[model samples]
Target chain A: MKTVSLAEMKTGQSGRVKKIYGGRGMVARLQALGLYPGKEVTKLSAFFQKGPVVVEIDRSRVAMGYGRASRIFVEVGE
Target chain B: MKMSPKPKRMVLAGNPNVGKSVLFSQLTGARVVISNYPGTTVEFTRGKLQAKGQAWEVLDAPGTYSLEPTCRAEEVAANLVNSADVVVNVIDATNLERNLYLTSQLLERGVPLVIVLNLIDEAAQKGVKLNVPRLQELLGVPVIPTVAISGRGLPELVAALPKAGRGRGEARSPDERWIWIGSVVKQVQRVTRRRRTWLEALELASIQPLTGIPIAALGLYLVFKVIIGCGQWLEGLLENYFFEPFYLPLLQSLSRFLGDGSFWHGLLIGNLPGGQIHLEESMGLLSTGIYAVFGIVLPYLVMFYLVLGFLEDCGYLPRLAVMSDRMMHRLGLHGFAVIPTLLGFGCNVPAVLAARNLESRRERLIVSAMLAVAVPCAAQMSMIIGLVGRRGGAYLGVIIAMLFLIWVAIGLFLDRVLPGYTPSMIVEIPPYRWPSLKAQAQKLGMRLQHFLTEALPFIFGGILLINLLHLVGVIDLLAGAFAPVFRSLLGLPKEAVSTLLVGFLRKDVAVAMLIPLGLTAKQFVVGATVLATYFPCAAAFAVLVKELGVKDMAFVAGIMLTVSTAAGTALNLLLDTVLPAPMLALFLLGLAVVLIAFCGGSSDRRESRKFTLTKERRV
Candidate 1:
């Protein structure tokens, strides 16, 4: 199945970033953060509307944008 | 210069943005060499001074928080503190509690410490009163209340400098320091429940993420308009007054007298068909390069530095960091990254170095890469203003809009791809005050001095190199080889191929080279924007390589090359499809959406992760 929103994924979920939707500045920003696909990610938190969401990928803790989380497609880890 | 017998040495250490520089200047009559710290490129200045008839060497280390060093500046500061005979711990008088933490760390190391209570006047004006003598007694160190900008208490500071020794300074550990600070504050500082004034309200408003970002945008816009407009006006004046009326005629007559066939004539008069220098139109070394440097780049750089120094001295930059923290969080970095971004505006060399303050290597690499690729320094921006803004105000708006979009895109991308813990933001909001004119002027002069001393030589060398290349026919050969790529990939003229070749040496000079071509407004915008984002100047590149290591620097260079070429090529295609007005409007709209989406997504993801962790804990 195709990956769905990060919000829908479980704690051990992983996914490849499919498409980045933004203009020149926006895409460049996303790319800089290492969001481009083919990388594995695991969710660490998901609670309040505006709280810290921790994700581990590339041996580093990455905090994602709220909208970015919603837009992201993740596949659950086996 | 020979020094007197047995010269004294003192190392200056403090939190970033403290008036350590101002204090150092007051103490040292000698010029301080200012640039970013090694490893991380934040600027530091070192100088020599004569105090009590004894010559002393003052090493001003970049701001560090504690002795247990995390960032590059901290490592350097710690090293200096360990080695120096005396450590002058300059503390911002307003943020005594936070500033004292570093002092505590210094005391722990058992260094000879002198606490310069800087910005005392501003603290008092803000209604924060401090009993300096009482505090000094408590800390078991000599505490000098200094209005460093005005040289107040400088004599006392000098007098007490020599008596420095390793003493059991009271605040040796973090807990002990805070406890002592609390007790001392109770005794010396009076806290009144004063209502917020309009200005305080304004200050608070400025730090609110929503309000602050817009304010930052507006501030940037105003700065660009003023600096760019001033540069153009001066350029016209210099052209008409100095070149057209005087230098052109003199050069022409000299060329004729020298009988054009000589090598000096070729070198001096260049390859003009008539072998005469028409200074107004001719791009001669003396006329063009000097005109470009003085008339164009210097004015803008000076003006930009003046405003930047004022903002820095006024203690607004830290507050700006606090305000931008929310947005920075979206990029997997802390608020302090804003410091690098601000420095990047002046020059990326120092900006990339300043990135060392970030908590993790990942954040540093991301910031360094972004700065190199996206941020255009004062010199490059000045040229952009000349080319783009000269067309009309609308074109100027589009270029800015494009830059904003690029910043947002890069930040968002980096946030997701790079793996690093985003440091929790803990910024001290320094008291707002009017910047001292003397201090501002000194800072401006220091920055300009570095630019002139370092960059000017390279600029001249670059010109000479280009001349040699052209004379030896290498330029023609290279231009031909690169012509297909230039036309298809970058949509620039083959002559522009040479400009690109020289761009790595000095961006301002490269852009100036394009002036002779008389490209249309759209072409100018595309070319300038791409160049601004393409590659950092040679100095900045060297700093990046040193700070980030050769492997990472190579990676960053690859990214910059690819992005700039692709963006420039894409822009050329898009320009043909859309009319100027609609294209600009669409671009701005797209940029806003991108920024919002990027910011919103990262924050939301962070929140969601936190939520699950809390839920797991409850379970």
Candidate 2:
């Protein structure tokens, strides 16, 4: 298992959320959208290198800004 | 004898982008605009529903992911659930696990609940099947599977409403709730591998930058072509077929009956210059006012709303939002800002209302201010075209380009100056669906109805007010007062002052007023561009004042006044000397470079500091 920020995850890579590095509000907001720790997520696409990232979580696609995406740590299998 | 019981308050709550709105419309038969993206319904809509002789007040609340509100729209949803006698928790069947999170929250609230599994057909197509009876047993609530768009399962839904009962009301922490949800899903849901659909491929293509950018360009081009081309065609048809042939003769006879010089005649038919009534130049309430509203504005409004409705329903708007995220970030906004900006093109009133979707006050203020100053609604755009398009297409192009530059400049300037950093966008991109013709038509109908009822009277009153001011000599007094600014700064004739004064009331009417001035091409471009930038029209002004509060509205007004004057003066100076085309291009490019460099450098430092501050707060 390798840990990386969500922003570093390659497209189509699936990962288990390890930790979220942000304020309590940010973590709660993500949790509400079903992006809590231990949940699985797949990087669907990134618009550009530094643009927002799109990820699929529980069969729904969510687009997160680059900064927010960078704060999410996920564990990926090699 | 018994007192009638108060109507039960039924609130529809759910995760964003589910079919709550569709279900609300079906249940109440109230046609509110339903779109494919989240935050489409920013405010709750109330409608009356009578089922089995029991009166119910049905409210379609703004969609939210949880009862713990994250933004303004979510706060509205959270507040609404409290008053709901029975809450219908709509869940997207295809996204059961994510949706159930909200359902669990609702369950914890212990409100009378009915679980609606919507989009069942789409889930089936994706090889997801639910044992609804088992799901109901596990959740301890009545569950109804529904296809909201098709109106299937609606009867059963209504029948099950009376059976709604509070589920297990045990309060659970976020982690505990997820564990419970997992157990429930494991028992009642099945997912089998299936072939990816073409729509899935298209969805992937639309978010990848290489294809998405080109697709975005083509999509926007088509939208504009449809709006402008079809709008003009309809306008011509209305004028040539209906207004010119039938309405003019009747008005002329009325002019004769009222005795051409009478007060009522002037008020209704306007001045007969050379014994002819000019629809565009006539300032009468009935002549120019009716022609402006129905003849010119209505056609364009219809087309704009139709295309906008299509974009909203087909789920292309969210994709557009995602594509524009990078560009928007430069302006201190996220992708969601595009929604209000696009709505501003149709009308600023709804645009101001739509700004509620943004998470911060600073973002809302910036959008509102920029919209007021730079964006011209369809009505004004049509009039501008009529006023300037005849000069040359290039002249109109210059005016549009100038507005775009101003829009960007205002965005950048506000981002740097505003106190807080823009909240990052965390939005869901719903899969593109085939837009329903019925829903599109309904949305179009609602917008047209709003326009006719709200705007038609304002136009007539403005014309009457203008005519009254002209008769009372107030117009000449105001014109004399502002004449120096028009003559010196704008290079417009003294008579053009009246149009600017009328501009505050209605932009289209003000541009139409420019018709009789017969200004030079340069003056025409300056006048049209200045009119668009000067201020929001009366209808839009009212909405802005309500949305932005008094102080921010004043600030926005100040920006409008300053920007319009600067734009007018710059255009006049540039156009008067007729600089070479390449020189003009170079000058504009230089200005853009300077503006970007000045704003970008400081903002980048401020943004990093903000991130660190947030991190400290978290610790």
Candidate 3:
């Protein structure tokens, strides 16, 4: 399946990040944080109205802008 | 810069951060000279003095605690102290007792000593009065009270030097010296108890277990927030306005000319496997590596050093040490571990060496291990925060939680595995005085200059080496060779296999390589964790080899490699099968509970009362 919005991410779940939707230099940064395809990630928390989504993958934790998180699709499972 | 023939040598020795370099600068003027010591790469500064119609060469040795050095700088100071004809023991009079510990050690060594009671004015203003002449008589050395910054007491210090040199020709027992100090103080020194200041009360409150830890946590929280905020702000400016607007286009144009297939093209731009201009993965000189170091790491390190320098100059470090002593003991370290840990925030090499001051071999080993395992040096942290924290603030918390847990857990495990008595911390907490903005700025400038000149070159060279390897297909070979380890053991991609191969050379450069391959969140987390916990940098490895010898260094390296891979693999699989959100969070909460249970029970037991505070007075 193609990547889904990070906002659509389910709590207590796992998925792969398809893309970072927005932020001036965020796409580059998202890549730097290991937010590429074919990698497993678990959603930890989403904050506020349209706030960032926190996720854990590979023993490292990262947060992404909700707008960007939304642009990315994840094949969720478990 | 020319030295006079038969230049009489003078050496400056003092506790770290006591303004010795400032004194050295003032004494020598701007035309002072500096050189490496005879047999060591460590540099020593020498300035010519024309006092008493005799030309004397003054050397500003690095600071140390005692004659026995626990760090490289201290070792250099000890060597200088032994070689010099006249030794100036520059003491910070504010913390008289702890400073005197070093003075006492120097006195035992029988070095020709002239005591520069630096910060005396501050001491007196704070109601600490010293009988200078009585101290001189007691210690059998010349004592002068001068604020080194204002150039006070230089003439008196010069006049008394000849006499002090003669005094050191005779050796005396440390007990005799202590008795002498007692007699001298009895004759001349008088301390009138002043009304307790708010700072004094705060100091007392800060060291008490009930209050101190929360204060420390708050302090750390504030510092981290400020540091992270400043880092992100500066990184935004550099990455967007500075590099993207101007530098990247220029480099991109230059890459076009290099024709992508030429030797310099691949060497400079890195091999764009599909010939795509990968800004993050450009093995080229002008692409990923340069941008990584200059754009990403530089701004953060600059800000970090400034904040740390301000903290150091204000003398809050010693207070923090005292406040954290109890928790540090639980972690199998003394409060002094705070110093090395603080240093590790700047660079791990000195932090590892600074571990020597710990009371036991076990403490040193544990501290050293933790520093290597959990604490990312300024360079690495800059990249991590710049790259990961940018994803979201939550990611910053995640990174912090992961490392903090590792720091605490590894410390606890080592404490259990290695049984040794930890030295009690009786550090003198200097009053919370205002830091001199000018001095702080100057010191910060010097450290930044040192970091740029000495360290940045190594960063570039490491990148260049990786570029060469990528060009020669060596990186691929190594990655393929380690594919089983990465795929099976760590569950990371084969492309990530190369970054880990490069991490040992320099961590920031390795992390920089990640910008190109563009892994998802999972790959990034795994890659960052493995790199952070892996072996020390190339320079640090060399120092460790020298300090620990090849055999012991190998042992440490083996443990680190095994633990790093296992931790990464376990974390990956745990997240996969059983360790979900509540499970991992619950596990962490449970661990904290177990820790509190174990630690509280031990300290609450009857044996704790054996060393109650009433036995000896608190400082």
Candidate 4:
């Protein structure tokens, strides 16, 4: 297993969330969207290198800005 | 004698993108727009439903991920849950696990609940199976599987409503709830792996930058072409067939009957400069006013709404937002601002109201002000196309490009000046679906009805007020007072001042007023651009005042006046003396770059610093 920020995950890579590094509000908002630690997520695509990232979590597609995506630490298997 | 019980309140609650709105419309027979995107219902819509011979007040609340509010729209949804005698918790069957989070929250609230497993057909197509009865037994709530769009399973849904009962209301922490939901899902749900569909491939193509950008460009080009080309064709057909042949003769006889020089004649038929009633110049209630609303504006309004409705329903808007996020971030806004901005082109009133989807007050104010100043509603846009489109395509392009520049400039300026952080975009992107023709027609019908009922009267009143002002010399006095400013800065004749004054009431009418003045093409460009930027029409103005509050609206008004004056003068001088079209285009591009570098630099730095701070804190 390898740990990396969600932004660093390649397209189509699936990961389990390890930790979310942000303020309480950001963390809670992500949590409400079912993006808590231990939840499985797949990076679907990103717009540009630094644009919003699209990910699949709990069978739904969510597009979030790059900065927020970077704060999510995920564990992916090699 | 028994008193009838008061109507029971039933609220539809769900995570974003469930078929709650479609279900609401089916139950109440109300024609609310059903879009395949989150935040479509920014405010709750109330409709009446008669079931079992009892009146029910049904509300479609804004969709939220949880009962605990994360944004304004969710706060609205959360509050409505308290008033609901029975809550219909709509769940997207394809996304059961995530949607069940909200369902669990509602269950914890202990409200009378009915679980609607919506989009069942879609889930079945994706090889998903559920044990409905087992699920019902586990949750202790009546569950109904429905395909709301097709109106299938609706009768069963209505029949099950009376069976609503409070679920297990045990409060659970977030982690605990997910764990419990997992167990329930494990027992009652099964998935069969299947090959990916073509629609899935297309959805993937739409989000990737390489194909998505080109697709976006082509899509926008098609939208404009349809709106402008079809709008003009319809306008010409109406003019050639209905207005010119029938309405003109009818009005001519009325002109004769009222006597040529009578006050009634002037008010209804307007002044005949050469014993001829020109529809564009007449300014009469029956002549220019009617033609402006129905003849010129209605065709374009219909086409704009039709196109906008399709975009909203097909689920392309969120992708557009995603594509534009990088550009939007430069203006301290996320891509979500694109939703309200696009709506502004239809009508600034709804667009201003739609700003509620933004997370912060500062973002709302910036977006609303920018919309007011830059985006031209369909009515005004059609008039501009009708008036200046005759000159050439290049002229129209310049005006559009100029407005785009102004929109960006305002966003960049406000991003720097406003003292608040813009919340980043975190939005769900629903898969593209074939828009229902019935739903599109219903949405178009609702918008047209609003235009006819609300805007038609405003247009007529504005014309009447202009005629009254002209009769009493108020217009002339105002014109004389602003003559030098108009002549020197805008290079417009003194008579054009009346149009600007009328603009505050109705911008399309103001643009139509320019037809009589016979200004040169350059003057027409300046006048139309100024009219669009100077103020929101009275209807939009009232909405902005409500949305932004009196103080911020005043600040917006001040910005509008200053920006319009500067833009008008710049257009006048640049087009007249300094540069030709190509050079002016280059100059505008340079100005944009300089503005971005100057105004956007600080905000970019601040954003990076904040991100780094969060990173360091994590370590």
Q: Identify the candidate with maximal lDDT.
A: 4
Which portions of model 4 miss their true places by more than 4 Å?
B1-3, B582-590, B593-601
Model 3: per-residue lDDT, tens digit, B204-258? Answer: 5554445666887898888887787888789888878888788877877888897
Candidate no. 2 TM-score: 0.96
**Residue range B82-199, candidate 1, lDDT tens digits:** 7787889988786675566677667667788888998788677666788888888777788889887788888888888876646564444334555655566678776444566787
lDDT of 1 at B225: 72
Displacement of residue B422 (Cα, Å) in model 3 is 2.7
Q: What TM-score do all the candidates reach, one by one? A: 0.80, 0.96, 0.75, 0.97
Per-residue lDDT, model 1, residue B403, is: 68
lDDT of 4 by residue, B1-619 (tens): 4433898899999998898899999999998978988888989999998777667899999999888787789899999999999999999999888888888888888999999999999899988899999999999999999999889988898888889989777899989988988899999999998998999888888898888889899999999999999999999999999998999999999998998889988888998867888888988999998999999999989999999999999999999999988888888788899999999999999898888988789889989988999999989999999888888776676677678778888888888887766767799989888999999989999999988898878888889998889879998899999999999999999999999878988999999999889888888999998999998898999999998999999999999999999989989988747876656766776777677556663465577788887678667
In angstroms, the error of model 4 at B600 is 2.7
Candidate 2: the clashing residue pairs are none
- Binned by DockQ into CAPRI classes (incorrect, acceptable, medium, high), candidate 1 is incorrect
Q: Give the Å shift of residue B318 in candidate 2.
A: 0.9
Local error of candidate 4 at A56, Å?
Answer: 0.8
Task: In angstroms, give how far residue B444 of model 2 lies from its true place.
Answer: 0.6
True contacts kept of each: 0.00, 0.80, 0.00, 0.67
- Model 3's C-alpha root-mean-square deviation from the true structure amounts to 18.6
Candidate with maximal DockQ: 2
In TM-score terms, candidate 1 sits at 0.80
User: Against the true two-chain complex, what DockQ does each candidate achieve?
Assistant: 0.03, 0.79, 0.01, 0.73
Residue B278's lDDT within candidate 2 is 81
